[model samples]
Target: MISTRLASLLFCSLVLLACSSKPNQDYDTGYDFSQLHTFSGITTASNSDPLSAQRIADAIQSSLLTQGFKQADDTAQFKVNYTFNITDKPKKSGLSIGLGTGNWGSSGGVGIGTSVGVPIGNDSAKLQTIQIDMIDIKTQQLIWRGSDNFSFDTGGEDKAQLTQQTVAKILAQFPPQESLK
Candidate 1:
C-alpha cells in the first residue's frame, strides 16, 4: 500500500511539472547582475487590457521586492518592460466519424462497422504569452529576457491569479545564476 501511494504521488508531481510553463531565459553573460539593486517596469498599452497590465506590473514589483530588489523612480539602474498577449487558440476538439464495410468470415457475408467520437466541454480557449525584458538604463540595451506561453479555458480562470502566476514563473529565474555564466 505504501509503495502504491508513493507511486501515485510521484505521478502527480510529474504531471504538475509537465503542465507548468518553463520560462525561456536569456541574459548578457558579460553583465554583472550583482550591482543592480533597483528596478522600474514599463507596461505597454498593447498589453491585452489595462487591468491585466496592472496585475502583471504589480506581480513583477512584488516578486522583485521579495528578491530583495527595490523599486525606484525614473533614475532606476535597470528598467523592466513586459508585453502580454492573448489570442484565440484554434479548437482541437470536434466530432470524428468512421465507417467500414467488408466481407464477413461467413461465406459471402457482408459486415459493416461505424464509430463516432463527440468531443465535450468547452472548445473555446486562449493562448497567452508574457515576455519580460530587463534593460540597462545607461546603455539602453537589453540585459535579460524571459518569456513563457500558456493556455487557459476562456470562461473559468481568474485573470488576476493567472497573471500573477505567469509573471512569477517568468521572473523566478531573474538575475541568472552565476554558475551559468
Candidate 2:
C-alpha cells in the first residue's frame, strides 16, 4: 500500500510540474518588497508594433491592479517596464551520423549508424523574449526582473492573447518574495 501511495504522489507531482512554467527571475536583496504598492505606466517598452506594446502594458497594469497594487504616476514607488524581442531560431539538421569501432573478446568490429529527427510540430516558429522590470524611480535602479520566452508568429491570429499571456507569465514573479529581502 505504501508503494502504491508513493507512486500516486509521484504521478501527481510530475503532472503539476509539467503544467506550470517557472519564469527566470532576479531581484535586489537590499530592496524591501513589502513596501511596494504603487506603480506608474510602463516607463518604456521596446517593440516595433505599437499596438502590441499597448496590449502588453495594459496586461501588466491589469495584473498589478488585480494583485492589490494602485496606479500612481507622480508618487509611484516603482516604475513598471518591459521589452519584447523576436529572434529566429537557427534551423536544426534532422539527420545525424555516427561511427564507432570496438574490440570485444579479442575481436574488432566497426559499426556505423544514422538517425533522423522528424519534427512533429512546426520547426520554423520564432521565439520571443519578454522581460519585465521593476525599477526604483528615485534611484533609477532595477529592483526586480523576470523574463521568459515563447514561440511567436508575427502573423498569428492570437497575437493579442499571446502578448497578454506572455506579459502575465513574466510579471507573475514581480515584487519578489519578502524572504529575499
Candidate 3:
C-alpha cells in the first residue's frame, strides 16, 4: 500500500531527473559570426565512440550546409571540434533509521536497502555532455561554442538516431546568433 505509492513516486522522480537539459550557446562577443563563410574539420574528442561520433558529425555538417555554409578544401575560415563526455553519477539512496530496546541491549541501527537508484534503459543512467566548438582559423582561437546536457543510457536503442537527433538539437544553437553573442 504505502510502499507501493512510495515506489511509484520514486520512479517518477528518477525519470524526471534523467530528462534532457536545453542546449546552451556561447561565443566571443566581439566576433562577427556572419562574416564566416566556410568551415572544416569536425574533429571529435579523443577516444570518443566512432560510430556515434560519425552520426553526430554528419548531422552537424548537414545542418551547416542548410545554414548556407560550405565545406572547404584547405585553410577554411573556421574549424569545428566536437566532444562527448559521459560520467557515472551514483544516485544517493536513502537510509532508514530504526530504534528499539532489546532484551540484550538497546538496538539502533540504519537499515540498508531502504532506497535504490532507478536504472535507465538497459543499464545505469549517466550524465552526458555534448560540446561543439568553432575556432577561427587565422587566429587559432575559439570563437563560438554550443553544448547540451542530459541524462541517458549508453545502451539505449536506436543509438544512431539518438545521436543524430541530439546533434540536431545541439547544432541548432550554432553560428552564435548576433544578439545571443
Model 1 lDDT, residue 123, Cα: 58
Model 2 scores what on Cα lDDT? 0.77
Give all candidates' CA lDDT scores.
0.77, 0.77, 0.72
- TM-scores, in order shown? 0.71, 0.70, 0.65
**Candidate 3 lDDT (Cα, 0 to 1):** 0.72
Q: How many residue pairs collide in each prediction? A: 0, 0, 0
Best by TM-score: 1
Q: For residues 1-181, write the lDDT of model 3, one tens digit per residue.
A: 4554565567657766866467888888888877788998788866556666676688789878887889994958998998888788654444543222223255333222434455444444576677889999999999988887555555445555666667778877777666444
Candidate 1 collision pairs: none
lDDT of 1 by residue, 1-181 (tens): 4554565567657867986768899999999988889987665647547776787788888888998988886658999888888887865654443332333464332233445544467656788788999999899899999998767774334767777788888888998987245
Q: Candidate 1: list runs displaced more than 4 Å.
A: 1-16, 91-121, 155-157, 179-181
- Model 2, position 13, has a per-residue lDDT of 76
Better of 2 and 3 by TM-score: 2
Query: Taking the tens digit of each residue's C-alpha lDDT, what string does model 2 give over 114-143?
Result: 898776566666777778889988898999
* True lDDT of residue 23, candidate 1: 87
